[model samples]
Target: MSEQEHWDRETDLLVIGGGAAGMATALVAALEGLRPLLVEKTDQVGGTMSTSAGTVWIPGNRQSRDAGYGDTEAAAAAYMDALIGALDHTGIRAAYLRTGPQAIDYLRQRSEVRFVPSGKHPDYRDMPGAAVSGRALAPEMFDGRRLGRDFERIRPPIPEFLVLGGMMAGKDDIPRLINRFQSVGNFVYAGRLFLRYLTDRLRYSRGTRVVMGNALAARLFYSLRQQNVPVLFETTVQSLVRRGGAVAGAVLRTGDGQTLRVRATRGVVIATGGYGHNAGLRARFMPRPTPELSVACTSNTGDGIELGLAEGGTVAPDTQGPGAFWTPVSVTRRADGSRGVFPHLSLDRAKPGLIAVNSAGRRFVNEAHSYHDFVEGMYASHREVPTMPAHLICEAGFVRRYGLGHVYPGTTDLGPAERAGYLVTAPTLARLAERIQVPVEALQATVARYNDMARQGRDLDFGKGDTELNRFNGDPTQQPNPCLRPIEQGPFVALAVWPAEIATSTGLQTNADGQVLATDGTPIAGLYAAGNDMASIMMGTYPGPGTTLGPALTFGYRVAMHAAGRPVDAATGNGGQP
Candidate 1:
């Protein structure tokens, strides 16, 4: 058969991966009159996004203006300038800032993806341009029932994030659930959430009322279904099709053993979720003593980066932090033998009555730092102290009030976690230190010193509740320093945590328009990249909430626009040399 005869399918655009970026690309392509096909390696859509908080950081968004923040695009740019010291990606950074709000607006009008400004959600940093609430948009709860049978294709949220085994709950729900017994209104709200979940469980695998990243992904999936977009789940792109020295299409391998060749008239876009699960790439890119854990989907094994390299593409170098995005994670063995990697985001770490200590039982970081910065602290502390597997010390009251890592608040019974060796408990501080293999005397002194400072409403050592961001995430009900409280009650509990990546900063080099760039620092025609597959616009520095997803969706939209012969900015981005 001839070359054209071997083409099993043909399309205007071939998109790899079904994460937020890939899904948006296909959707926008269709809207722009380009026939696009999206192929996901897993049986479901939503890569890491489905398991995330799904907050999109788009400054100057309509919701922000309506909410009275009225942040300007210039102010956002100034914030980025103040936050990121390196100017390595100035061109793309400008593009992201310029187009991010537009992308959000585009999706709001054309797709089922709806977002509401999260009330009082502050930026991770209190930078000059950072607003207290308007910039961060939380996904609106999406009713999975809208997708019908295709609802099953939407990946469920992290098993641990669910309430009552199948019900989805937001960060707002947790505080209410914790205070449910204290208020009739809170009790009614909690009861209604449970009731809705129970009703949905009668017919669905999980509650159809999805929020966060699950809702965001589900909304995208529903929107695509509405447009009749062809989404090939359980399929992956094995290799890129090169024609006339440019990426034209790909060889797709289905979940079954079948291989099919697909040719694209416009080009191919790679958004394969980056190298989080790729052993070789992890070894090559991650820091020394490479962490063996990641919370991202297993299907994200650097397929896009590898494919891009075959066409002379280079992996963009990150000047700050590690190539991978950092998060302090606790490992838990599930009932099915698979282990759960739980990233300690805004929950337990920042709440009062908890202290994270190195192996020597000495306090290190503020603990209220952002998850990325928290892991960075772990690495820095580990250089002198064994900060790896640092233990978070708390008490019964602490867990009851705020919970630890995967442990839920108001959890009276710690039997399951204790029996599984996931949590260590002791009636006294010395005993708990002994149980966790930390110096007993050192641990006792640490707790005593901490209690003294906490009683004064101060973290003398690390200044835990100093930053606006820290106070925002801390327990608001607490007096004085919300992130500072004595951990004096027994039986004290301990949960071990280690640094792990939730995503990657390093990826295939791509221009502002999302076209994958060759080693010569020129755009390779018929090729584009987005999501974690594209080098981060932040240049490896995380500035605020939804840092990853905001740019992922923005650049994804830009890619689709460029693919459809409509570049968001007429000027091609500099796409800085590697």
Candidate 2:
């Protein structure tokens, strides 16, 4: 082949991965007047955002500031320190904290990105000194018409499990919506599908409009395309090209096996997501049976981390990385082999008729904690069992309210659920326990004690009354105690549950500028990482909501800012003045 043929393309910034971080970096770079090239393993853009509700849990963000909520960079950092405690990486936190507002500003100014605060959602308080609100932000709902033809290619994040329009609402707002449940406004609010269908039909023939997660992906993708940022789909980066102790370029292989030597003038940003689908990496990091509850994209194979490591990058030794933190949730599969994994609490939340119990025939948790706590508790709950599978005990009433799994009211799967052995129903707790293979006497004793506590209006053992969210999901009409509603009626059901993780965190460590770090803690020149490819700066715990996607995007912007040699904001100390 001619030398000209070997050199396919060259650009100022080469972005590996098409996820939230990768696109953010590339878009920012393009806006800064640099030629940005993005390569995605999948055929489309969006990454996990395409499959997520797309909320950005940003503490002290511009949205919060606009809402008259006071927040400073120092306050954000303080919150971080309190949350992560000893595991906190100051440099990484500094980078995210400083660049957050700038990133939001950059996107809003240069792209179709527009966000609104899901007002009143607080930081997870159990993390030391967490706050109540003035933190979380989400993309203002958008019409799918923005994507036009691209709409069919991406997956919308699942909002069906939660209440209507509640995908990005703050924790405080949840109560107001719930309180007004039986009202006319509440009926309209709850009828999201009906509203969506009517609006789309009137506006456009394509009744599929992007909102929340899909909106985020569409907005970024729109910005990326407008800026003429080159996105090469079905192309994967094989390895890094090193020269003068710095990354010079990358060796890329297209789906057709055409090798392209693309040179990078400034740097290469690796945002190729986590290693959730790679079973081999899962065994190494998780070292356990992570049965399929992880909702992460199948394309997340840790390729970016692998390529970076080959070039002398130091991988963080945190078990909190991908495959480790995500619980392998048990899900009901469709005939086409697709499965629906609701973070578990959604079933317990709005449905009001199910309770989660462990192998010991006893309720383990409040069953309505936030997704972070629910997954964490599941991991802990597994330690007490032999196979580590909890039976999701539900009733006929629960199924009738929320619609079982993918087996909606009238589906064929519902028929199976009705069959003899699939769902078990008995008159007494002892009979139900006996059928499900639990100790009958132990089950009866546990229920009686729980009933007594319910009569007294307190959960002394588990402290269930700590969160208002828990109380909301519990029966409100019930007298003294809402959460203590006994499973007295017949017709019971149990679905085996497991720990399914969404993404892995184990990846290359990076500096404040999102530059990949070497073994000696030196920043690798011309190399950067974001998203699951980089070691999560947040340590093992999720701070609030949107913990993963929020930093991924902020760091992506930082990488672009650094690459373009832009002046950093003096007030926040994020990007240094060129």
Instruction: State the lDDT of candidate 2 residue by residue for 405-504, as single tens digits.
Output: 4333322234465452334555566667877787778666766665567567666766554565455455567556555555546566566666776566
TM for every model, in the order presented, reads 0.96, 0.86
Q: In candidate 2, which residue ranges exceed 4 Å CA deviation?
A: 1-6, 68-75, 86-90, 157-207, 287-293, 319-323, 337-340, 345-354, 399-428, 468-484, 567-578
lDDT of each: 0.87, 0.68
- For each predicted model, how many residue pairs clash, with residues at least 3 apart or on different chains? 0, 20
> Which stretches of candidate 1 lie above 4 Å from their native place?
1-3, 86-90, 318-320, 571-578
Candidate 2 overall lDDT versus native: 0.68
Q: In candidate 1, residue 450 scores what lDDT?
A: 94
Winning candidate number (lDDT): 1
lDDT (Cα, tens digit) per residue for candidate 1, span 382-449? 99988899999989788877788788888898888899878999999999999999999999999999
How many backbone clashes are present in model 2?
20
